[model samples]
Target: MIVITTPTGQIGQQVLERIVDSGKSVRVIARDPSRLPQRVRDRVEVFQGSHDDMDVVSKAFAGAESVLWLVPPNPQSGNSTEYYLNFTRPACQAIQSLGVKRVVGVSSLGRGFGRNAGILTAAFEMDALIESTGVSYRSLRMPYFMENMFHDLESIKSHGTFYMPTAGDQVLPLCATRDIASTAAALLLDESWSGQDSVPVVSPDSLTPNEMAHVLSEVLERPIRFQQVSIAEYKATLSRFGSEAWVKDYMDMVIAQNEGIYDDDLQKVQPSDTSFRTWCEEVFKPAVLAP
Candidate 1:
């Protein structure tokens, strides 16, 4: 059996679909089973609860051969480090007790920046805990998702601008979530590879924010611009909604990004098969045009 956490999530849903197509016995841990597509419900066993719950994961991990582990984002989390670690610790125990042979986890880039990278630091710690479980593991070290632009959809449509807490000229690596899902599904299905490794799923293009704005303008046929906000301003904006810890961690992550956190010399990276312009023309354009 293959166990998937966050099966209703963007990348997880895609991964579940692909794995289901292979005719494998699959199970998922979700808070609300109703959120799962009916077709998915028919094919996989549903453990209706958060994966962080020991009872939920212990039950789901039982007799599973492989697992796809993804730590869902919680912007409202009181402590980002504790949030990631606490969510992962239960699954690590379940992996050991349940004799699960392999694991494919969603993680981020910027492993060795030697600073508090907020969420990225938390992800790295999650990767470590999972690895310590001694299960054969594959950490899909992902870069910035192109779909992150969707958050600024309203801003793009209304003001012709998108905001970021990064230098305009810094080349931000990008990857589509579909590519991340594809990578995870492939690893989850295959039982051949053993031990642990990091698969850096980054897109081939090396585009700065200014270049991204240029592509958006041509694709949408509008005058769109990239606006670089200061870290202080970004923190202030985030502070309006979430808890103080949440705001600090998010801002710290952005600070790490501005400090070149994702600028690691990754070797043997099999570039993800999506470009910024392709994403703009295909994904972004439709999103902007949608009513």
Candidate 2:
């Protein structure tokens, strides 16, 4: 049996879609079963509740061979470490208790990446804790998500501009969530690999925020600019959006990225599908260019 957590989320939903279509015996843990699509509900055994709940995961892990784990983002979370691990800790216990062998988890690049790197640090720690459990694990160490660009939809639509806390000329890695989900589905379905490892899902193409602005402008047929904001200004922006709880930690994370914490990670993994231009044309342009 293959168990998936957060099946309704962006990555999880795609993973569930691919897995269910293969006609595998699948189960999911969700807080609200109604959020699941009608077809999905009909297909998989649903254990309704947060996967953080020991009882919920325990039930889902029963007779389970492989699991896809994704920790939902808690933007207002006070401590990224606690927020991530608290949810993962229970599953670690359950993995040992249930004798489950394989786990494919969504994680970030940089293991000892940077100081005060909020959720990234939390993700690095989560990898450590899970590995200690002696379970065969594949941690998809992802870079900046292109889908993260969508968070700027309103900014793009209104002003033809987007913001980030990085040097505008620095070439950095990026990937789409679709690639991450596709890779996860491939891993979870096979059950052929074993042992703990971190897999980098980085793109072959690297671009600066300035270059991204040029591509976005050409694609949308408008003048779009990339604005490099200060860490304090970034915090102010987050605060305005009611995301102040982890502001300091988030600030450190962006700084770490700009500092090139994952330069080694980028060199490690083969580039998967999805390019920046493709995402801009297919994903970003439509939302901003729509009537």
For each of the candidates, the C-alpha root-mean-square deviation to the true structure, in angstroms, is 1.2, 1.4
Error of 2 at 196 (Å): 1.2
Q: List ranges where model 2 is wrong by over 4 Å.
A: 112-114, 241-245
Model 1 RMSD in Å is: 1.2
Stretches of model 1 off by over 4 angstroms after superposition: none
Deviation (Å) of 25 in candidate 2: 0.8
Residue-wise C-alpha lDDT for candidate 1, range 1-291, written one tens digit per residue: 999999999899999999987878999999999999999899899998999999999999999999999999887888888999999999999999989999999988889889999888899999999999899999999777899998899999999999998888988888999889989999988979999988899899978999999999999998999999987888888888888998888888887877878777455577888888888888789989999
Quantify all predictions' global Cα lDDT against the true fold: 0.90, 0.87
- Per residue, candidate 2 scores C-alpha lDDT tens digits across 1-291 of 999999999999988988898878999998889999999999999999999999989989999999998889877778888888898999999999999989999998877554667768988888888888999999998889998888788999999888888889998799888899899999999967998888889877889999999989888888999998887788887776545557766777888888887787776789988999998888777777677
lDDT of 1 at 198: 88
